[model samples]
Target chain A: MENIHLENIDFEYAPGRRIFSGAAVDINQGELVLLCGKTGSGKSTLLRLIQKELDTKAGFVMQNPDNQIVCDRVYSELEFGATNATQGNERHRLELIRQRVAETAGYFGISRQINRDTHTLSGGEKQILNIASAMAANPKVLLMDEPTSMLDPIMADRVIDLVKNINRELGITVIIAEHRSDRIFAYADKILLIEDETVVCKDKRSMAEYMSRSQELRGFLPEIARSVEMSPPPLSLAEAVFGKAHAVYVGKEAPLSSHPVLRLKNVSFAYDRSKGALIDNLNLSVDGGSITALLGENGCGKSTLALLSAGALKPYSGSVKINGRKIKKAGENSAMLFQDVTLHFTGDTVDGKYNGMHPYDLSGGERQLAALDIILSKNPSLLILDEPTKGLDYNEKEKLGKRLEKLRDEGKAILLITHDVEFAAMFSDRMLLMFGGKIVCDRPAREFCESNIFYTTAGARLSKMNSD
Target chain B: MRRFENFNPATLLIYYMTVIIPIMVFMNPFIILTALAAGLVRAGIYERKIPVKRILFSAVLTAVMALVNGLLSHQGDTELFFINDRAVTLEAIRYGAVNGLMLAAAIVWFSAFSRTLTGEKIMALLWHLPKLALLISMIMRLIPRYLERYNKTGLAARINEERGQVPEKKHIMQITSAVFTWALENSMDTADSMIMRGYTSGGKRISGIQFRPGDAAVLALTAALQTMYFLPETWHGILMAVLCFLPEIYRIKENVKWKIYTLKI
Candidate 1:
């Protein structure tokens, strides 16, 4: 039976700017529906229409968790929906609400943070709290509008797992609108493609069949699925439609250099003096004309190390040196690009309003490029980027990779701290793996991909699987 | 560190309002002194230590206010000397001192109030008035969020090369303008998110903390103290002074009891 059904729905942002017209959608029980489209293509609007918090028994999670959390504390945020559902006599219902909050938080592995301030939670934890709050409402269907769009790779994967678990355990139908199809496409049962105010719904089999017929839509396929060729692409290498994996290209690594552009010696840092250092006694150097990728789990001090290396943060002990001289001020010899691109825009540019529009109104990829351009205008000897490929599409990621390569060829030292293993594999000359505020391994990018199994790229994984 | 941080916010509101109203009404020298001393103690407790710098700044401010009042208003009987052909009388100085003390006491009490009454506490206390509670919460979030965005905007202005030849003042002005604009625009998203989460959906917001027995006791005590204002001027003034110092007296009694217990052991 269809849990959610919409017939001939018309949605328009303004009189002339029509988004959806005569769109019809039907979602069945226990189905994992995937909503795929370009940005501003009305995916979120459709989800909102379906959820309609006032009328339907549907839970909607927005893109940015920071804006979604309605309460101050974690426990209160989780209870927000349930409290809104209560009719009368809060004293009697609060006990049940508390129990529900505790149970939901425990299910999402956020029970320890129940008493913590919601605003104080990390980005990943905030997204988890958002999902937990939605589930506490006891909705029949859960609709998430790009829930993982603002999260790092680690957090993004965790959110997907939670969605999968909720569907499997509770038998609740789930619909997710996501741009990162590479991360979410595997678990989907049906695919809904929205474009130009039209919605086309299809099962996985028919969707793959359609992809086989159209090359334009093939770009929407996951990277792992694209590694092999067949009538319908495979979700995993183990279940490939093709006979074997294609040959994966590996980039050549640059030679090591003695003269370094930026150097860190015995650097240590701690947010609180009493809790001990988060990054302890780390020493490293980035040679000019090379791309160095720093890889680590979220909250493993990758960003802190990036900031320290960029001279934005001074170490408690030791020093940061640029061109073998002690750094005087931040941004004098370095420029750091943070994960959030919106925080880096100047709101206006010299050239006729920066692409003829405001920075905030631009697309995610455009905003990122604008931010990069702004940073590059400083023309620092060293470029330190923290998760630069966070919200970029495949084409945008390629453009950024080319830009970084050009910078490297210009003898500019680049420190790329990212969760994008594939992008790093394509561009980086060297790779450094950090665990618990310390570098555990440093190797050439090629060797690094060939050595590791889990953290390796999808192309490398497919190659290994085929070779076996 | 605030002694009343986690107490029922309604109780804190009643307690502070009840204490401050009488101090404003009586305006007597003795009553003002008691209120000032109590205000300082409350601020100290909330800060978890003696805020020496703040106290010194308040003293300087009090002196300035007293000096201004003494020079501006010459309504005293006993004239001491003349300053620029104006009578600088002893009675005028004393009256200015009383006014200054009242202003300083109010400032200190408010400082403590701001420290203790966080956004969460205000929301809990004003659940019945949802719009007002939401406005207070939004303002509380706005200040920190604005500061953070302002700092980031400054960094962005530099990266954009907008600050290359501009002076520091111009750079600061540009960054401030950008931050204010962004904050205004971002508020729309915040409002939408709140609405999507079922805010203002004609339902009662169930606060986590309910009114407990101790909260009721606090409310009763504040109510009884408020009634003392109707008593005779001298008698009521003395009661007001004692009420102001009640927290300090309790703390002293508790500390002495603890010290004696330690000595016996």
Candidate 2:
């Protein structure tokens, strides 16, 4: 396979702010390169270039599952490229393409039933389907932009393993731009440190040295990798402790109020008459003056419960109250961000008149941020968001966490349902471990998850704490 | 496998050229019947049970459609029978039935395409095409993405109690407004993406994705079929039309990937 050579390549979206200029680099074939950078450091843009999605033959698995699926049935998506050969007819040929599609689907572990509806599948299933789809496209190069950022640990590892298989067997070159690199770190052939726009350093280095030597490298460190004696670190509680205790708290007192911000009693919701209720007889309470972090496996109804709390969905049999007031519909007093930001950003009034662009054009993370911007700017009394960390780089999530702390200081009852335990822990005073449509554990954020636990951030282990 | 049963778009077109197209243009019943029989045979190639079911379903659908058209479009010879005040002639019914069957066959045939081949694979075959095809493919990619998004959106809206019948007037206004909003946001995003990629204000140019010879050869064949269809000689015209129409067989293929893609959002 041929590789592109860059000589003094320079670029910037806005003038004067050079994202990458006078940069020369050669990326070899058949390597899984990991990119490290802070938010807006152009990691995604770089990936786009490499994947040929932007200007470059590399295939990309879209960050948002919604963006990846182009067809209705999972089988069709797999065979769509082949079936398309005989556009209007070719009935027999279409059937022939089925077995191969099914095989590829199986590679991703996608069951037969889930292939029918791409939207309804779980996050991991969607990711698998997307990867398989991209791989089948037969691109020589693959560039993944935080492909597993939002997935559960087990599923994320599975996807990584799948990618690894393709890389090894098929010799498909892979490039991954990730903030937290625990999953792919040991496996990465080369580490490219992207900081402050330009690639500061590239090539070989020990993981420990790579972690410590560069100032810009700090952002990619796993959570709880630092101990906080006085206050929590910006990324982790420990980092806050070491920086400045009083400043970390920053004139904000720990949440003392125990009043329930949201209360759901005996709630049940059914998607369709045939499949049975998705959530059944569930009871939950999220208290006020405290950052409440909700966690659960995919399809465990974490978002459903969050909706009830946010007054988006009324429980079938039970009642949901926001600060003792029952919710009748979705409106002010509360704002809920959906798992996929595109679902909520369909702005009718804002199209064509301004920039000839729809909210749909933005990437998944951008849409999420945009939705958050709209809700936060609106000054809702209770802020409810779903998978807010999705599509965001590590630094963006941290910035959002810091923003949440500021919002908390402003007395906004923040209720978040997320797959990100570190994100919730970084900001919340309280945490709830939810799975299988129920809360498995609930406790103070300070007393909550250890780094090694499920849903915890990668660098959150006590042993990994940075010693200054 | 029977050649007729192998109705992938290319084969379907070849069969259409040899059969259906001629019948349509020449107004010949023999050609149509001959092609239809061939379809039945080819339909049985892969799995015996599958083709029979496909043919049966196609025939039923076609027959139903033909019956409806015959009943409504009663301007033909009254060779068969009469129902009510309307003259439901055997000739008209036959004509309508044949047309309906064709429609049904085409629909099922195309669904078979989606079943067998995928979009990415087709794209690989068409890799050498101009940027327009790539853009078309990209937009095609968006169809399923949009459908999924819309479905999820509708569900979210329903759960949020923002969904209601409201009145036709309000509904139209809301839908129009939503569509308009969606369009604007999407365009802006495309622009942003373009700008991000250093797309200067001009026609598109390909920086990468050179076509392999295999894909180029496929494109040439496709182009040839398209040209043959456009040629106006009665027999050749018939042939080309049939070939060109083969890809339209799978109605679901034109739609999203989801087996059941409803406007849930």
Candidate 3:
């Protein structure tokens, strides 16, 4: 049965700025659907329209998890929806709401944190709590807008797995709009591609075939499908055809100068004196004209090391040298771009057409580029970026990768602290893994990805499987 | 686990009212002293340690108030000394000290009350006024988030100022404006989330607290002891002591029972 049906619906922010005109789509019950598009391409508008149509029967989860939360306590947030839906303060009705909240909390494996304050939860935990609260309403349809765009890979995987379980076990329909489709492509039953004020819905194989033919939308294809040249492209690593597990060259290694641009010797740092050091006696150096990537799990001190290198944070017992001279303050000889690029703008406007508009009004990718432009104007020898690709689409990531490459050609040393393994493998010359305040693995990007099973890309995994 | 925190919000409210009302009504020295002692003990039990800071603050405030009152009011028979030709008497000092003690007892009781009645419990008590309760809850949740964002924006402003992109004098104003804009923008999403969840103004709120038999027993015991306030002064003082330390006595009993059961095992 068709769970959601939108026929000839038109939506627009203003009179002339039409978002979707005569957009029609049908979603079947119990099917997992993936929505793909560029930022500001009406993916969220479509979800909101469907929600407007479905009214109280549909649950909507937005990108920013912090904004969706309405209650201070976790248990109160869990029952917020049911309480709103219930009419009178009858004993039986409130009891049913409590029971539903308890059951939903158990299903989401969030019972341990049921009584916690909402603000104290981690980003991933907050998103999970949002989903659980949405489910507590027992809606027939769920509409999620880029739910994992702000999460790390591990947390994103957990959320995706939970969504799959919800679709299979309880038979609730899910339509999720996302930027990164590599992890969820295998599980999506149908693919809905929104472009040019129109919506096209296709099955997995047909969507892959169609996306492979289009140049602009081709980046949205899964890595396994994009890498192998075959008819009716595969949706997963298991079904992909691989010839050999050859180590493909990621990029030309930049010639190392005699003196590295940034160096950290025996650096140790801790935000608090009572807790142990977050970065303990770590040593690292990045030469000029090289793009280095630092990869780690959430809260593994990757960002602290980045700050230490950028001279934003001082180590207690070690020296941070830029161009063989110890630096004393932040932005002395290096520039750093924070993960939330919107924070970089303190003015009402940015350069060019973004003038007269607030920085928060721009899209994610545009805001990032504007921040990078400001950082580059300082002419620093070393550049440090923390999670530059967060909340950016595939096209924007490609643009950023090309921009970083251009900077590397100009003899600028770039250090990226990120959770994007695929982008790291595709762009960086060297990949380093940080664990427990130490560099556990450091190698060329190709070798680093090929040797590790869990940290490798979908294409590398497919090739490895074929070789095995 | 906090044992007192598990009681129903209504029971906790009544417990605090019965304990505090008598302290405000009666000016008897015996009643005030017992209430102070019981308030200190109860606050200690809730905090798991002596609230030395609160006690010290109260002591200093009480001493200063007593001194001021004793010197200003010259209505006593037994004059101890003359301060600037104004007599300071023993009876006046005693009266001032009793008033200070009464204020100190009230302070200690209120502190203990605040520690027990957390935001959630207060919301539970205000469930009948759903709109006010939700507004308070959202404010409590969003203020910390806003403060965090403000700090982040300040750090970003500092970074920009270091790069010479932002002027030093204008940065704070810029950050304040930026955060204000960000809050206004994000509030739209918050509103959408509320609408998506089918929220209405007059909807019923569920506090998720169950009124168990233990809650009823505590309420009944508090009501029985509250009647002693109308009795003789001595009886009222003793009963008030018991009333104020009821939660501490319950906590001790539970701890002893668990210790004995574990030993038997």
Candidate 4:
């Protein structure tokens, strides 16, 4: 059964500024579709078009989990859609709505937070609530735009798993647009590629093959699919084990510098006096001419450590020294770039090229680079970035990686806090995993990734399984 | 307390009105004292601890109001003292004290009312007016989100200032403008989400609270007790006390019933 059919759909933001032209897609019932494109490539616009085309009820979940939520409390948000759909305030109808809310909450494992304030939930929990609320209406189709783009790896995986479960178990058609396709690609029954005012829909295997042939779109493929050299490339790590292992390049370790750029000596910090220290006696050093990646779970002190090293936060006991000089204030010797790049902008124009344009007018990747430019103007020897790859596409990440490498070559120590293992492996010279308020593992990026089990990238895991 | 909170929002709304309206309308000293006592006890029970700071603040505020009124108005017969060549009479002081006590009682009752009728309950009560209820809900959700954005933007602006960018006093204006732009942009997405979820379907809202027989009983009792204010001053105070402490009495009854039931088990 055809759940959604879009034929020769035309869309444009303004005259001659077209997003999609002669674009068509046919999605069947119970099928999970993946939408992939570059930043500002009309992924969200395409999802909105699909929503508009559907005559039946369709649930829509967008990025930025905070905005989509309309109710103050979790239970209210869950039943918001159903209450808005039902015609009257009849007792039986209200009871049915309550039952649907309860069932959706239980299915999504959000029953524990059923009474919590929607604003109090974490980004991941908020996104889950959005999904549950959308599902509460009992819609025939669900459309999510970059659902996991703002989440950590664990939370992102949990959301993707729930999405997959909703598609498989509930028999509802799911169409999701995501930049982080590595986690969701394998479960997609059909892949929709949007580029240059056109939409190409193909089955998963054919999409993999098609992506492999297109150099620009190849980055959209899963790491396992990209690593395997097969007729129809394997979509998952388990299937890639049967294929031949590709030769992986591990970069040579850089020589340690005697004078480190950013040094944290026995740092211990806690936000609350009653609670344990978030960063307890943690020591780390990032040398000039090297990029260091700090990997950890959300709230495991990666960002706190970055702030400490940047002098934005003071440790309780230890000293943070930039170039062997103790720093007393934030942005004194180190430049820190926050996750939201918009925070870094104070005016309309960042530079001559982006003159007369609002900072928000720029794309996500460009805004990040522009923020980096503003921060770099300080000429600080140490640069600290928190979640730099949060909402960027592959191309943007690549651009950011090259820019970081250039900064490293200029003898600026770069400290990157990210959950993207793939970006860390591909760019950072050193990898440090923080757990339990301490750095548990510190080594060269490739060596560190190759040795770890769960923390490693899909390519590393695939190679490890093949070698096994 | 939980059982009291579980009553239908309509019943709770009516209960609050009946309990508060009489105290507001009748400025009798006995009625004021009874309402104040009940409000303190209810607030204490709901919060799990006596709000000593709130009590102290209210006491200081009432004393200041009484002192100001007594000093400014010297129309009474019995003069306690002369302040700025004007007599401060005992009758004037008493009148001021009563007015202050009335204001204080109203504050306490309203505080208790706010604590009992949370945002959810308020929305539930306003379900008959779906648009207003939704607007209230959206405001409750967005105000916090907007403040968060403002704080984040302020922090970012400070970060920029630390990096050799000397923003003037207009920094606040800059932050506000940025946040406004961000809100406007994100509101589009929120509106799209609302449209997708059938927000334009003109359907009535249905709150999750169920109106049971116990709620009806409480509503009837509240109505009956509130009407006793028309009887006499003494009866008004007595009935008002009963109406105000209804939740506490019900809680004790339920506790005793549970104890006996558990003993039988």
**Native-referenced DockQ of model 3:** 0.65
- Please report the candidate that would top DockQ against the real structure: 3
lDDT (CA) per prediction: 0.75, 0.58, 0.83, 0.82
- What is the descending DockQ order? 3, 4, 1, 2
Error of 1 at A42 (Å): 4.6
Task: Tell me the number of clashing residue pairs for each predicted model.
Answer: 0, 86, 0, 0
Worst 10 residues of 3 chain B by lDDT: B156-165
**Residue B178, candidate 2: alpha-carbon lDDT:** 62
Candidate 2 on A308-411: residue-level lDDT in tens? Answer: 66666667788877777887667536777676565554454223323544565554445566666655544666778777786566657766787787877777
Question: For residues A1-468, could you state the per-residue lDDT of candidate 1 as single tens digits?
Answer: 337776788877889888877756677899899987766778878887876733436777877877777666776677776666555576877777777887888788998897787667888888888888878877778888888878888788888888889987888888998767775677788899886678888887677667656655665677776556655677666666255657345444654674699998898899988988899898888989999999998778998887777666789999899888887666767888888777665446424336467787777777777777777876888888889888666666777899899989999999999988888988899988898778887888877877788777877777776667
Residue A155 shift from truth in candidate 2, angstroms: 3.8
Off by over 4 Å in 4: A12-15, A23-25, A228-232, A255-258, A466-468, B43-66, B81-85, B162-167, B226-232
DockQ of 1: 0.24
Q: After superposition, how far is residue A140 of candidate 1 from its true place, in Å?
A: 3.0
Q: Write the per-residue lDDT of candidate 4 for residues A175-262, one digit (tens) a residue.
A: 9998877778888988998878888898888888888887788789887665556556777766666656553543335544545888
Task: Tell me the native contact fraction for each prediction.
Answer: 0.28, 0.11, 0.66, 0.59
What TM-score would candidate 2 get against the native?
0.61
How well is each residue in A214-297 modelled by candidate 3, as lDDT tens digits?
878877887766666766677766566443333333323433443489999999999988989889889999878988999988
Native-referenced DockQ of model 2: 0.08
> Model 4 compared with the native: what TM-score?
0.93
10 residues in a row with least lDDT, candidate 2 chain A? A244-253
Q: How do the predictions measure up, each by TM-score?
A: 0.79, 0.61, 0.93, 0.93
